[model samples]
Target chain A: MRIGKRSSKLMMNLYQRNKFKIRATTSNPRQGLLVATFLILVVIGADVFMDGAIRSRIRPMLVPVASFGRSAVAAVAGQDFWSSRQALLNENESLRERIEKMEAQNAGFEALRDDYEALQKMMAVTDEEGEKGLIAPIASSFRASPYGTFIIGAGFTKGVREGDIVLSEGGFVLGAVSEVNAKSSLVRMVFAPGQKTEVVSGSTGFTISGRGGGNASAEVPREAALAEGAPVRASIYEGRPIGIIGNIESASSSAYAEIHVVFPINLNTVRYVYIVPGNE
Target chain B: MSNMRLLLAILGIVFVFIAPPWLTAMCILALSLRWRAWEVLLIGACADILWFPGTFSYGIPVVTLFSLVVLIILEPLRNELLVDRRMI
Candidate 1:
């Protein structure tokens, strides 16, 4: 009789286990969804409630991952590595052509610079020794940041500090350092949304309102002598350029012409940046 | 979960760090269509955490805000269209 009772109990336990598994798998997704929704809301609230301490700690931990991703992207963009010989050969050929084109462009730019210098001399503008700093490799994708910021591999250990000016290879202002970690620093673009910079295109001076995503716009009097491809400069950087005029929108009746300025180099293809270290 | 869905979900997080914002948004939207993948919120939060830099300075974080919007928008469709009519 005892042996019979034991066998019956085992059968009961097996049935209950199977029923539990069924219930668990087919459980209402709505409950899970609602819970997740609540949890995410709570996370956001905590982020705000705690004064962003939640993000401050969590973000720094992601530096290694961001660094790795940036390295991978840079390598892919340059097409510098491949296991296949055919792929390597193709990359070599493309790089050679690219170098030739760049060399010609560089020569043309030199002549333009000479002409610009002569014009500046004629105008009696004084030459000044501009700010200089170290060149740092960009450690994050430029467009990935929703905040109009990007990461650079150099940081405090490398003399990078907050408010350092970030520039493209061509010496156009790109951004300034906003946050610095030991090995990486975050740079907020000059044209970040809600920011404005005073720039001069020819003799006309105006404020360019940042539209984010690497562009800014300004409005000048229709007769300000603004034209497409005109270089824009800010007096704060001495003679270094900020960006170039991209598109101009004006009509015969309008009193103001809309001028769009953009970085000469595509931010995505940029791999390295020159930093002019900040005071604090 | 199927392999493609799993891969897409994983890539969604990685792309937040390296891919363009629009592409990351697409990845998040695609995953939200299939499952109420709460990972969407995670990836969104990831972006805000990585790039936001400071508190409320740049306004409310857009990536996280957009991810939340994506998940909420797709919830009803997932419930209506899945083969099982609810989730497995």
Candidate 2:
């Protein structure tokens, strides 16, 4: 009884001390509004002058915390989930067939790579020196943002410079490093809203505009011959395939063809991206 | 009630990084209905830094703006619903 009374007295005293300050701010709604406006202006001013230095410093620290929370949630969700023996057997058989197809595809890619290297050596082309790549796991994803972007686990300390090309497995273009801090970096994907890139459609050149949500579209002249599943290569990356045309629609009112493009790899499932240096 | 508000504010900040954007926004809105939670703006700024690409010119910080709007809209509701119970 005494302990409970003492704790309640302590709480009452603490509340009494802060009561006036809280009322002074909340009683007059106009004062509260002014305070909020001033704070927002301060944030905007900081963003403008600091050049994102404040953000770079603070965001990297949260990467590990966010990753831990994600892992914990996944673990809790997986704990009660189970599969039957027949289901597991079926899944195992499917994986074996998939592995066989992947091996065949890998052999074909190795042969192509060998031929390309031989041609490069025969031509004596050594202008572009190859640089090592840093593999970084994704710390946070774009799904959390109102806009489409993601954070990677590597940054300036790991030699991840801005403008470095981020690629998924098989050299598929994911994005470029936009901001780098000490321990993490932000990647701006090719399909982020308002992001524009110069891409060549097979042989035809056009500028594609990002429509956000891993989708992009470009307008081509009516006379240009383009089809679904055509390769779209980034001009800045030496014609490297960035996306493929998913569909084509003829604008009846305008003299143009609307081409919809999509990235080959799913952004959500991508765990790690290869950060190729010297591409900036 | 105040203790609940404080707990919600902390959770809101944590959810900015771990949970979805809507949950974070809901927490901020709830806090604003009770007290002047300026931390919402800071949380929004952190969200922008973590997910937004600094290089992009067009993308604006939506969370901060949304928090400001909620605070403004909730001001009248707070005045009507909350009772002044503390003694000077």
Candidate 3:
């Protein structure tokens, strides 16, 4: 009788286990749909909530996460190694090019400096050298928001500050820092739809406003004597030259001048930037 | 669970994040083989949110609508392909 009871107890345990498994599998289909929906909602909500306040609080932690993702992919695809190789080749090429260009430019400078120095002496006669600032490699691209602007990945740790200037490679000022955090800062580029900037065209010597472009050339004042290929620079911050003036518009308003300045660095490909300290 | 699927998923996610406008379409095309219509749309939407978080506001509705249209139209075409494969 005791032996019979033990066998019956084992059978009962097997039946319960099979029933639990059946219930678990049966519920999984409905659970999958619910889980998918939950995930979708979360993704959407996170995007909506990623405003300045949240970003200011969260971005410090986020930087490491983003860098990890980038590095992991880069490692797996051998792109990191490839990029290092390419960078080495580029440095070698640039060094050779710089030497050649400097030699050519030195010859031209000798002739121009003779008269330019006299004009400079007459204007001020003070020889204060421009201070050199640190060149920080941009670790990542700018993070953009709707209510606010974009944030770059270099900050005070790299000697950047609120009023410091960001530059494109061709000596044009991109924008100034609207806000700065520990490791990164926000830059409000002059090309936002509502953004207006005062720019002096180096080639044309016309004072025009950069009204930004949507799909076509930025609108410039009809009377703002600017050619399409004119090089433009902006003093968004004092002593900083922003972007090159891009294509000129056939001005509609006879009163206002508008010009599109192409950002010196491809805004989309902004992997790195050089910050020029304002006080320097 | 398969290594191949995980590899593909990671590649798909990465493409969704950083792929330029031209390349995103290519990524979507590549994904058509293994993913259902809804899954592909969800992946793309996730990528957009990761990149421009600003797009999140307009992206959810737009992606959902786009995915629905793709399902309504492409699913019929896919059905034919699936039937052909099964027959072969």
Candidate 4:
């Protein structure tokens, strides 16, 4: 009661002090609107041009906060105790088989790497010919985003940079880093609406534009020998396969065929990605 | 009632990072219905800073733009409503 009385008194005192000015502004809504408009415009301008620098400074602080939220959610989910022992045993067995397969694949990859290095030396290509990679856990998903983007818990300090290529665990192209801060980065997925990329159709060498989302469409000539399930390769990576042709449609009247390409990786479930440091 | 509204607004700002955008939008709208809540603009700016990519990808700051629109459209309605109640 005492606090309420003091607050009312303080409010009355403030109102009395600014009574005339407040009345003038309230009576003339146009003047108030004009001032508000000007201020908003100034803010928007600053945000558009200077947002990167601001995020770069602020994201480091947000990283720990985001990590805490993630950990809390994980802990809550981990407390589920309804699964049977048999189910757990089956899952463990499957994991062991998967690990064995991965070990064999790793051995093959080592051999391939050695052969590639020899070829590179023969061609006089240096080790610095390509960018290095940094792995980062995804801090957030697109649940809050209207656009196709997610935040990764790695940033400038971890060698993540704007325009760096983001790839899945299997080296499939996922997206490119659009914004980089001190401790986090925003990756714009290849499947984002309105995003486009150049791709070459398998063997045909026909260069076409690929759109975003799990499925991308390209215009091919009706006479082109493109078929469904054919591989589509990224032009920038010199024919590194990124997607497969899902469908080919052509109208009898039109000279061009509409080809839809599908990405191999399920983009939604990706929890971590590798950031290949380079200019996009 | 005012305190409750202020508390909700503060929660809305924090929820920008942890909750869906629509929830945050709903919170801001609820606050606007009671008062001008000009701080919603700042909340929107913070959201943009935390989540929005640069203008190279998206042209405008969406949350701030929506908040400004709400303020512009709602301010006069609030004033007229208050005056009508006073007259009654």
| DockQ by candidate, in order | 0.51, 0.36, 0.10, 0.26
TM-scores for all predictions: 0.73, 0.68, 0.48, 0.61
> Model 2, range A1-280, lDDT digits (tens) per residue?
9999999999999898688657665475446557767977686668767776666776778788777766555545544346566765676777868976996788579657755654443233122324467667778745565566777888898888988887765566778888888888888888877789999885689998987767899889978877788878897765667888999889678899888999876765566667776456
Candidate 1 segments exceeding 4 Å error: A1-28, A80-132, A235-240, A278-280, B86-88
The global Cα lDDT (0 to 1) of model 1 is 0.77
Q: lDDT value for candidate 4?
A: 0.66
TM-score, cand. 1 vs. native: 0.73
- List of clashing residue pairs for candidate 4: A191-A213
Task: Give candidate 1's total backbone clashes.
Answer: 0
Which regions in candidate 2 have their CA more than 4 angstroms from the true location?
A1-40, A73-131, A251-254, B1-11, B19-36, B55-59, B73-88
Tens-digit lDDT track for model 4 on B1-88?
2586679778777667666677888877876665656666766766776666655355566787887788667776767764332211
TM-score of chain B of each: 0.84, 0.80, 0.53, 0.81
Query: Which residue pairs collide in model 3, if any?
Result: A172-A242, A173-A241, A173-A242, A219-A258, A220-A258, A221-A257, A221-A258, A232-A245, A234-A242, A246-A261
Write one digit per residue (lDDT tens) for candidate 1, span A111-168.
Answer: 5775565444323311222434776777777777767888888888988887887777
Sort by TM-score, top down from the best? 1, 2, 4, 3
lDDT of 1 by residue, B20-66 (tens): 77788888888888876777888888888888865676579788888
Model 2 pairs in collision = none
Per candidate, the number of residue pairs that clash is 0, 0, 10, 1
**What is the CAPRI rating of model 2's predicted complex?**
acceptable
